[model samples]
Target chain A: MTADISLTPPDPKDFLDTDSLFDEEERLLRDTVRDFVRKEILPNIADWWEQGVFPVELAKTMGDMGLLGMHLEGYGCAGTSGTAYGLACLELEAGDSGIRSFVSVQGSLAMFPIWKFGSEEQKQEWLPRMAAGEVIGCFGLTEPDSGSDPASMRTHARRDGSDWIINGSKMWITNGNLAQVAIIWARTDEGINGFIVPTDTPGFEAHEIKHKASLRASVTSELSLDDVRVPDAYRLPGVSSMRGPLSCLNEARYGIAWGVVGAARACFEAALDYSLERQQFGKPIGSFQLTQRKLVEMMIAVNRGMLVAHHLGRRKDAGTLTPHQISFGKMDNTRNALEVARTARGILGGNGITLEYPVFRHMANLETVYTYEGTNEIHTLIMGQALTGIEAFS
Target chain B: MQVVVCVKQIPDPSGTYTLDPETHFLVRPDEQVLDDTDRYGVEMGLQIAQAHGGSVTLVSMGPKGSMQGIRQALAMGADRAVVVDDADLKGSDALTTAQVLAAAIQRTGFDLVITGTESTDGYSGVVPQMLAELLDVPALTYATEVEARDGKVTINRQTSAGYDVVEASLPAVVSVTAGVVEPRYPTFKGIMDAKKKEVEELTASDLGVDTSLRQRVTAVEPAPEREAGVKIEDDGEAHLKVVELLQQKKVI
Candidate 1:
């Protein structure tokens, strides 16, 4: 079973005030991305949302800053670890989920498939452009009818001489409309295979989905592929099953697990500020039991999520982690993040609904977090099956 | 070709400047920050190192209270950092402070020294030149552009007549103006790295930087506030007012 898009868990210390978890190099990347988010993303998020604009240049800019697929070693990547990716996501989502979705899809989703499974020529052709953000990539797994069950996806590619012809539609694709390249998963004669289809292909069209409030700062689109012909070389060589698509899902989902922690931290910290300085009854609302309980619950959620994410990250870097471990983090962190944001909203009273406070926005972003990758229900089943040694994706 | 960047922490200048109530000058318990313009200098040093295959050693001088800027600079990707902390050097003038940093760098043995045009608190912008003079190295000020080619550095100095691109061979002091390249941000790994980065700590006496031998700051006082200006209208009265004002000041 595939975890959702935000598959990787970001280390909470990147966004939260964890005493000191990052080494100097990691911290340098974290602060660099954070300041970039502040200077670049913060000022434009509202406008971007209002205009339904996903700044395509942002990929290039972040790529220039060593943000795209940062954990991957060499080939223009930062050669950092999972925690560095988490920190980057933390800083990214601290701005907006829409912006982070753009990165998550571009880096973990689109680029990793090629990096992990592509040929040397493919890597040479794609990694640098993807790394530099000059080329945008999108993961095409979710179809109109197959959000939870990707095995039933209708997208198909047939071997036609040296080229493979693809036909199907991908739905809910972040940066789908602006993708310079796409990792489109389609059922071939053998099984589900991955293809790197550039957006400029002969019969490819991307229509921006009108009216999205959740990931408003991102470009959520529907991809129409009609006889999209990519060379056999563009096909991810080792990919031959649902696992190929699922592996990419795992990658994206882990990032979301960490990214939402950023959203939660932003929410919790915002509430903490309002609680201390915001007053009623001649004392700070934070002095009250109700408010304190909310804050404590939020902190508890954040800490538990951090522990899971960080340890999972260390395990992943050490090559001892499994996809189920990723499921646990995505499930726990997103759920906790949603709860924390909801609780933080109540703390703000009236200001909670306004973008003036980030809680409401975080609350909305968490909605997308809950549903994507594997849904919370799907993750529970994956973990449940992993514990019992039984498959549950029936 | 290792370069050492010297940064000082000063309070935010946007707020009103005040003297210590007890000491009758300067704010005590002032928060530490990298000098606003010095970030450019640090960036310039990093660029040079990247170009020439060397490291940048970051040196910050202030009380122990100034560690945050050091960490912040490390987050911006300095190879290493050192802090020179001494109680006697807390309020030392620009020349004395540079004396201490110069001693620290001598121990570290950097090929070049980079500093901001001026610190926020000490706005003299003269430390790099003085340090260069003391170290017997060429000094370049108000560097708008810097390019390190092979073993040589060509710096564009910001002069009143636009900017002059001057080339220095090796081992020189370069002061930089702000807005050259936006300083890099601190990543999660960088924050973690900064913690493990050994901030070699030194005191004034440890560097043998004797403040007693330096020019004594016997009196430190706030500059008198400027009175609000009275505008003179365009007429004979304006000329007369200007003449009378100069006459009252015994000028002309």
Candidate 2:
């Protein structure tokens, strides 16, 4: 006896029916961001990647849409729930990881510190405009030698009469070249103090970094602060230790925990569609067992990563989320997303190497995402420390 | 002016949809999205309400899950919403749907009622007229442009030839086509605000409307697959073959 069998195409990336987990409003917020990405980012992303330039004007568009600092309250911010903000990150990263990074740097790194620790006068001066996207902002903390160990930063600030003079440099800063304000963290007599310095201040300069293989569509730059003097009032008075900057990094890392799932899902979808259409050996490549195994693995990783991100997001919204929980999610999701992207790239064969397919672009972007906002190794250590009552990094 | 817009929840047209083999009703997926055509009607209602200094209320009837579509309209700037979801309303025909909607509208009290030309799935094109008859108001169909002033409404209605300008008093029913106005995407702020917006739910008993099915579908069949056409090679006799095929079909 002979048997006949046929293979069916895979469904969308939401194999677990994840939409049921969110309320209608959360889903609507996600759909709105998804539509914006489909219309604005997806069409021009490949070209923007090829040219190695970020569209500076989209800041105004995003501001008009109330995406900047959307989770913050008052000062023209949307004051949405943290879960809604995570959904926005997921949708933004679905288009490209570079877009999500720009928003993360602006909202979490730059605006978050000011919102959380800045004095009322400083808030009145900058929060509304930053939320409006009329003024751009960047966070300067990582120096050339300080990637993970920010406590060893060489940047220093000294008191000069009524003014404070800051001198140092920051590397691998997103939105640096386009920012109008820089939140510079420097060592002071008290401790690590953060100063909100205007980028146009005398002796302040930012140069765009060239020849980047990852995150090419984003503006990454090196910031130079040479005797940049500002009034003492520009210093954030509420925070006096490295905890100030580390808190901001936690916020951005939380967003990244949700963002990488989007990148992985996009790559998996691209590979799945290509495999079903591209024929080989008198049948679709999807008919092969090896291709099916790769696709299934990619799908599971994307779905599981989203579940972790969503759980963490809800916890954050409920005000019960811990930094170590965020670290666990960030570590698992980014590593799994990078694996999914790499496996999907393999399924695409030679086509995966070209920009015509999104797998390669996302794979390259995940490398940067894997390292920034606390590296995979750093998060693993954090989890290790949480599990055991001992610190690993001496 | 108080504007009431009619919205419907339909299966995603982009996905594969089928009719129930036994009941002949649409097999709905777990998630039912708002119809694309209704978005234009909601946008038009919002624009008119904004200009005339009034509130826009959305009215819809479907399964309990249909509240998703109503919430989407509310997120797009509607003031509030009323959804009629009851098990007895299943498999309702166009006229029955109109009756339920008419009852719901009477409860809401509207100066102007707007609706899409047709639902994407049903495509009946008769609900607006039936609704106007039940509400005892003038019905303007296929409106491409709408304006309201001095308790009167003017609309440019699309027709086969071109468009015809029509005027009606306040308390009228107007059906807008898909391209009547560009719909705005709900901003993040709008989506958050919608969570606080009020959504009133009712059932068929509350509306006091009989939802007995008047039209029944006995069977459903898939559309016939189109056969591939024969390709004529570019030989010396290609023109002759084309003429012969056309002549055989009595075309010329």
Candidate 3:
């Protein structure tokens, strides 16, 4: 006899039971981070976004919850599974992409470099404090002149008396103003080098990028290094090429693959809620065929994005993840999420324009998400290069 | 100080609920979670144990699947847990549940027992008192605050007006009301570590408690819905109708 098959309808919230893919600890981690977001971040996020400020105090709170560098081992880090880290990112971004960006920059970009490539002394001196959020760190690589091509970066470091004096500027640096330490990448005689530069050093300056639009709740700044000198002991000795910074970027891109799913889910949820309650033509808007089509499309995209992100996370944990795979995930998920957000915005109509609902805010944030950490076009080319053995970059 | 927190796995309160007409009992969905109300007690137990230099152990009785909810308490920093799960223990009443829990607590041993005033799903509000009676300990209910020190426990018992300070010696049961302490979110490390923590599972026979339920839910009926409000249209002198209605209701 055949086993009984119970074909139940999918849960609207999790349409595919994609949640079951995660183990117990991973699910608990997601729920805990979700709870923290609901209680702490969601209530005050709109105000913070409007004021163009991120509450830096949240770093220590997240640190206490072991969210900072939570996936790393040793030095006060939580050492959670890779999928757990991805799930945490998903929940954090569900609140706001800016919040998840803060965590991604801290954990994947900042701490991962020191843990993966820094000297024993460097890790000993900085990892614990950074993990505790007692000290904040930022990664500096992209410059005003270089967005997609790091090989064209103008920032260079010259050796002088067993010390390095870096004199260049970095643009679009996250956590720049708040970081106590910075992982500054500079071109050198040895191809490229990573420096552990203290933000308090003389001649090193950070100016907050101000004015209109996207990721306003996040601290983006420009760093001007006018002969910022550091001892040789401050340098990461593990490698001397673009590999050092590229690896860090790769790690961050993995998190982004998972994070944007949250942004999409949030917008989708808001639209669904609005559609049900909002009345048009003497009935709920959700009852309309056109509105249902949008909702169904959103649901499919979110479920598909979650599957992609989770698959990438598993591959990463198994040590089989490739750069092209990361690019595929980041590019596809971000594009899908942005589309979902835009569709959700249209569903909300006039209310979608206001910050009272999260739809507009998410749409605005997804624009930055789509552009940063290897822009959609760059990632698309990277995927194209993988599929066909051809050099696409000029 | 050894503390035991009595917790239960219940249906997700936020989800849609239904009742079985034949059994006259609420149908439990496949999605079950740690009852939100029990977090207050778990937090209280953790706090007392942390402050007094002892470990907190969670004691629960439910289906074997209840481990999902039990691990949640463990993730909140409880040292370990004892879960009594038996197929025959299904449809247990408050007294039956108390008997099973009392046996588990006896086997686990506790200097103090902490529990919520009632579970969110089945709010009988009598399990803690029954468990206290079964264990032959002082039952302190509706405690807004509890302090265990010097081989005695003191509680700020919430009353209708304000609160009363009630004290009892060691080995007491304190059912904390919500807001006694804000439940802490489980840290990432705690969540991972909880997987490794020991959760000793037992059956009714293993705990050696009687499985016979003394109370039965005979019939269930939905409460009557509220009557629609009186809608008086404004015919320029609607204030007179409102005043007259209030006068009939003796409010004027």
DockQ of each: 0.25, 0.57, 0.76
Best by DockQ: 3
Candidate 3, residues A57-80: lDDT per residue as tens digits?
988889978999998999889998
What is the DockQ score, from 0 to 1, of model 2? 0.57
Instruction: Give me the runs in candidate 2 sitting further than 4 Å from their true place.
Output: A1-12, A16-20, A55-61, A318-320, A383-394, B155-169, B192-195, B208-210, B229-252
Candidate 1 deviates by what RMSD?
8.1
* Candidate 2, A135-244: lDDT as tens digits: 99999999999988889999999999999999999999999999999999999999999999999999999999999999988999999999999999999988989999
Q: Where is model 1 chain A poorest over a 10-residue stretch in terms of lDDT?
A: A10-19
Each model's lDDT comes to 0.81, 0.91, 0.91
Q: lDDT of candidate 3 vs native? A: 0.91
Residue-level lDDT for A29 in candidate 3: 81
For model 2 the TM-score comes to: 0.88
User: Model 1, A243: alpha-carbon shift in Å?
Assistant: 1.0
TM-scores for every predicted model:
0.79, 0.88, 0.94
Q: Interface RMSD (Å), each candidate?
A: 4.6, 1.3, 1.0
